[model samples]
Target: MFGGQVAEVLVNEVPEDVYLLDVREDDEWRTGHAPGAVHIPLGTLGERADEVPRDRRVYVICRSGGRSGQATMALNQAGWDAVNVAGGMQAWEHAAREMTADGEGEPRVL
Candidate 1:
């Protein structure tokens, strides 16, 4: 776990039904991202926090683990159940998990 309080899970450990939030930038998101993820870049998450459901556990992710970790902490402090996807998209791609691209190219982590 990150910071000994924020929950952390590996890519393979994420449940198929969980709410996945991608906090990467626009360019990074265009490159590739999880199939069912909700795109709410970290910079705008504070204003868009209500868009995230408070009922279920939220799985936050980013290019690596850094940004997601921050998002997880913030969400948790704000009374949401959020877990950081450790190793982030890099690990997701390495594990051969499903991904989708914004454009016409093959989905890949940028």
Candidate 2:
């Protein structure tokens, strides 16, 4: 398994077309999230782990870094190639990455 440090990446470091997993709650997701990201709240990850792809690297993100860090470690131990988005959506917004909301208006990190 990879070390925690090795499993973390900044928003700018994330590549294009990757499997981005947003582990925030439904309300947070509706507020804002990376475009095309898959939603799997941290609480449901254990049962939904099977839904994450096995063949490619998965980038886990949350409000900040804590939850995604936990998820990164778990997924790595479970044999999935996972990495945490170090600063989460907060960093994503700071970096000016594309974001989409669930409904009307512009997307903003919450």
Candidate 3:
């Protein structure tokens, strides 16, 4: 229902407890992602959409905005309050927002 916002400002627009859904692949997720983001690849979103909460805002992201844009449409159709994170992780990294890897070592954007 709204135009997507770039990752830099999107991080601040939503509250601290917002649901940031990362629709990237397993490998991409392991490489790096926005802290506290939930990992549910775009392909599995339909079956797993229910896992995303409704109480807070839901923002979807991918390596770029393409997959998250697709997810935003699907989630909205399924009655979720979702938005796309424009420029996705690329922008998030460019903005210097916090990024974390799978806990074993330092985070690196891939």
* Model 3 score (lDDT): 0.80
As a whole number from 0 to 100, the lDDT of residue 21 in candidate 3 is: 92
Could you report the Cα RMSD, in angstroms, for every candidate shown?
1.1, 2.3, 3.3
Please give, for residues 1-110, the per-residue lDDT of candidate 1 as tens digits. 36677789989999997899999999999999999999999999999999999999999999998999999999999999999999999999999999999989999998
| Candidate 3 residue 81 C-alpha distance from true site, Å | 0.7
lDDT tens readout by residue for model 3, 1-110: 23443223354454565789999999999999988899999999889888999876688888877888888888877777788877788878887888899869877667
Candidate 1 local distance difference test against the native: 0.94
Best by lDDT: 1
In angstroms, the error of model 1 at 95 is: 0.2
Model 2: runs farther than 4 Å from truth?
1-6
Model 3 misplaced stretches (Cα beyond 4 Å): 1-14, 103-105
TM-score of each: 0.96, 0.94, 0.84
Pick out the ten consecutive residues of candidate 1 with the lowest summed lDDT.
1-10
- Quantify all predictions' global Cα lDDT against the true fold: 0.94, 0.91, 0.80
Candidate 3: C-alpha RMSD after superposition: 3.3
Q: Write the per-residue lDDT of candidate 2 for residues 1-110, one digit (tens) a residue.
A: 23535478889999989999999999999989999899999999999999999999999999898888988889988999998998899999999999999999899988
After the best TM-score superposition of candidate 2, give how far the Cα of residue 27 lies from its true spot, in angstroms.
0.2
